[model samples]
Target: MSNYKFILSGGGTGGHIYPAIAIANELKHRFPDAEFLFVGAEDRMEMEKVPQAGYKIEGLWISGIQRKLTLKNLMFPFKLISSIWKAKKIIKSFKPDVAIGTGGYASGPLLKAAAGKGISCVLQEQNSFPGITNKWLAKEVRKIFVAYDNLERFFPADKIEKTGNPVRQDLLEIADKKEAGIKFFNLDENRKTLFVMGGSLGARRINQLVEKELNFFKENNVQLIWQCGKLYYEEYKKYESDLVKVNAFINDMKLAYAAADIIISRAGAISVSELAIVGKPTIFIPSPNVSEDHQTKNAMAVVNKDAAVLLRENELDEKFENEFLTLWNSEEKREMLGSNFKKLALPNATKDIVDAIEKLLKKAA
Candidate 1:
């Protein structure tokens, strides 16, 4: 096997960062002698997270441009040019065999520069709708690994592959980790565990809803593992008790998934994909703040499959309690939802994505 040098770019959130890290980890396992570098937005979560994942990273002076024409839009060109110039320098120095992007504004300049240098490039699109960066780079990259269907309208039909998003492989073992998970989170094995995920920064609306419903949960005798995210940690950490374990972020999702009898989550692409693999009955509260309202679409995709329940922000007051109660009371309903969700999981997504990268490397060679 060739000792390849790889550059993976993407990150502003855990959604993009974790996929790139997962792909890099898989590539490292396959090519032990390989070298890896990550390019993400400056001072963003990726700078801190990529290093934590045991990889080197370079930060670009870029973030997403506003949809509307504004002063912020004026700054985009300068940021883009600066990022492109820096990306070229990184490419010239590293001379990577291949470049991979996992769909974020951070990847745009880096992948564009890498492609311009004739370095083989591949991309991963996590949402049902494509991000602006991936859509712009679609024509240049060798392949696009997508998680949703009907992406052919936005990407080249020949280059797009439905391999799903690369997720932490440890999730596959969640079934057997229930006992260990119960111990790890210090929860009573007798009480049903409810795992609440609001992303790396946490969801404000979801946090409020969870807080308001604490009395209801107590009445139901449910224990919780709540990942309120860094931004809201201080605001909500005071609610922690013997039955309620609150965290700023969850470092070990495998155990968290194992501990969940039912899950409440924001429907970011990576979180949705991970939930599908965890095969737990889930309630999706997708953020309306995302571009194109894609989080709602992501939740609807699973809901359309009868694999999860969705409560829109506007409807949560009227619908959340009824929906939660219906699913919570019915063992049969939970089983059906979990079973259907698991059916949508692509367990080999990471390996298959790495396989595509290997093929690209071979062709470049």
Candidate 2:
């Protein structure tokens, strides 16, 4: 019998946090008695989210180096060194069998400590263009799980495993979308349903554009399941009507994905992966706020392949309506986009990542 103990690290954003949790859940299902710990940035979303996901998480006093010269950048070295020391203590006391990183600033230090202690460590990168943290951690980590291909440029060739991003299990198979999802949102099944999501915290520019164009949706006979995000919901909620179902946060993503004939979303790697799996015709409005402009790169990875539409945030106001009208009216185009996108969905990512982790653990044992 093998015992499994894991230290999973990732955070700052749901893109990073959710993947770590999905991997943790997979490990738990396979090894029910396995012990798990999560490490995230001291004040990041993960600090709250990981616990909410039913895991104990420790916070490291760490922050990313600011792009511009500031006092915060001066603190980087101290934060990094201290975080590394703290992470080492966490690892030593916890005595985990393996450490997994899902690519966040905190994961860099946590995974580094685990690897320094000669523990099995796997790092998962969600983007086609790897983030600097994951790229830096790749050299030390034993395995690299990637959602996009051609990652050998970032990680060791031998360590790279092209496991698609693990999506929520419920999202894997969407059952009775029109009935279940439409009813959940109390939406009209007879009309074309457009699902708009700007990600968990929400995208300001996208929300604004949606607000600017809300009337166009009504003019076009489209019903909407709009997630305006917590920040913008209050400002945008007043615009909601029978044609629009607006919410600050959406808990039932599977239902949302199921109810949509078309989707408007931020092109985060995980969102892209889910859209690909759901095989929906999507318009990706990549947020410019992310590091390395990775969201645009992520959108291009699919848009270039004709799997989804790419609408730059800057151009969204002018082009969103035209693009929406085009995709909505063209059934053949929608099917083609969905077909190409579906081809990219790696449904077995969770299983594959767990298998890789188990292999590394067995070898180490």
Highest-lDDT candidate:
1
The parts of candidate 2 lying over 4 Å away from their true place are none
lDDT agreement with native, every candidate: 0.91, 0.88
The TM-scores, one per candidate, come to 0.94, 0.96
lDDT score of model 1?
Answer: 0.91
Name the weakest run of 10 consecutive residues (lDDT summed) in model 1. Answer: 356-365
Best by TM-score: 2
lDDT, candidate 1, at 310 = 91
lDDT of 2: 0.88
